[model samples]
Target: MTKPVRKAVFPVAGLGTRFLPATKTMAKEMLPVVDKPLIQYAVEEAAAAGIEYFIFVTGRGKHVLVEHFDHAFELEQLLGARGKTEALETLRAAIPAPGTVISTRQQNPLGLGHAVWCARAFIGEDEPFAVILPDDLILSDTPAIGQLIEAHAKVGGNVVATEDVPREHTNRYGILKVQSDDGRLARADGLVEKPKPEDAPSTLSIIGRYVLDATVMDRLGSIGKGSGGEIQLTDGMAATIDDGVPFHGLRFEGTRFDCGDKVGFLKANMAFALDRPDMRDDVAAFLKDMAAGL
Candidate 1:
């Protein structure tokens, strides 16, 4: 029987070096897209997917990421006194219910594999879980991670979100070797971490969302450094495949923004703002006028 995926691990330990000065003190996941931070979007996606236990793998100075989900008593009191019902309600809505959120520290700047392994205790030995990278902000009618969760329920093994990128850009992602595919779902024979264009198996590249079995934690525990001399999560997942575990990739319906990039971050802000009913017209008009100027 397929156990429900109740927990999700969020690796928020990255030193957002790309965003430099702006991220010097702030967690990169804390960077805002429109009114909500990137991490908040990820949390909402996980929540929408029915994930109840949020396990955040944090680093030094990443306390704010956990705090973001906590209650702000002073702010709430002030909002209540000022009769800011809307803002207060919004803030209250964002807070996760007590005892549902938990966090663990990843002391070293290890890779994604290690970050995930840090949350092994939170995810027991036999339960399946999800790992969401806040860097990839996916906007979809149905939550992107929820799509993967549904696939996981059927596949009962492991499922990763996949998208086709240009062959030239294959080296930027974990490329999947498609054994068989039926349009939306592809059974992966293998996964390669950031393989060069000539070495890539297929153009279907793994994205930041994943619904994985707990056995992956066992693989991640003993897996050695791979690719760029870091403990790559792709390497661990590949090991699971080697262990005769089934792995599949889902071509989820979504528009993804690589929020780790400056251009992508700016584009996400514009896209999300345009998605709002209140801001859509004003943002659309501004964009049109700006385009006319260009």
Candidate 2:
């Protein structure tokens, strides 16, 4: 029987250099999309996917990322006493149950691979785990992480969320070398990290969501620095492929927003605002007027 994917690792250690002064004090993951933070959306997606234990790989001054999932007693009391029943319920709903969430620190800004390595102990030796990048906010009817988990169950090895990018833009992502593709799932012969347009084997690029077997952690520990002189997770995963591990890419159903970029952040805010029933009409009207004025 395949081991159930019970825990998820969230790599939230990056310094949001792009978002500057605003992130100087606040963790970028805490920036709100509509009303909820980016990290909240990732967590909610993981929870909906049946992830029971949430492990956050954090860095200096990123305590707010963990705190967001913690209960605020004073604030809850104030809401309850003021008879704000709806507000209180919403607040309570966001906090995970006691002992289910934990955080571990990545002491250096090494890379995405190192950040995930920091969560190795929690993943143990044989369990399958999920890694979610809060920077990639994916909106879909079914949670994005859940989609990867479903693919993992069917394939029983490492499965990454993939999307087709323009061939000219393949250099920006970890592109997959297709062994075979059947519309939704593509079996990868190999994965190349940010290959040049001409060298890219396929247009399918790996995104933020991943369902990985624990063995990949060992590979991460030994791989050399890649790409921008930092340990790259793609390198670690590609190594597993050489060991004959099954690697697949799932074309998940979602519209992904890269919230790490300023333009992308603004777009995510607008898209998410337009998604809410309470605010959609007003937001659409405002956008229409703004477009007309421009």
Best by lDDT: 1
lDDT of 2 by residue, 156-214 (tens): 77999999999999999999999999999999989999999999999999999999988
Best-matching candidate per TM-score: 1
Lowest summed lDDT over 10 consecutive residues: which window, candidate 2?
148-157
Candidate 1 TM-score over all chains jointly: 0.99
**Model 2 TM-score relative to the real fold:** 0.98
True lDDT of residue 102, candidate 2? 85
Candidate 1, residues 154-268, lDDT tens digits: the string is: 8978899999999999999999999999999999979999999999999999999999988999999998888778899999899999988899999999899999999999999
- Runs with alpha carbons beyond 4 Å of true place in candidate 2: none
Model 1 clashing residue pairs (backbone): none
Work out how many backbone clashes candidate 2 has.
0
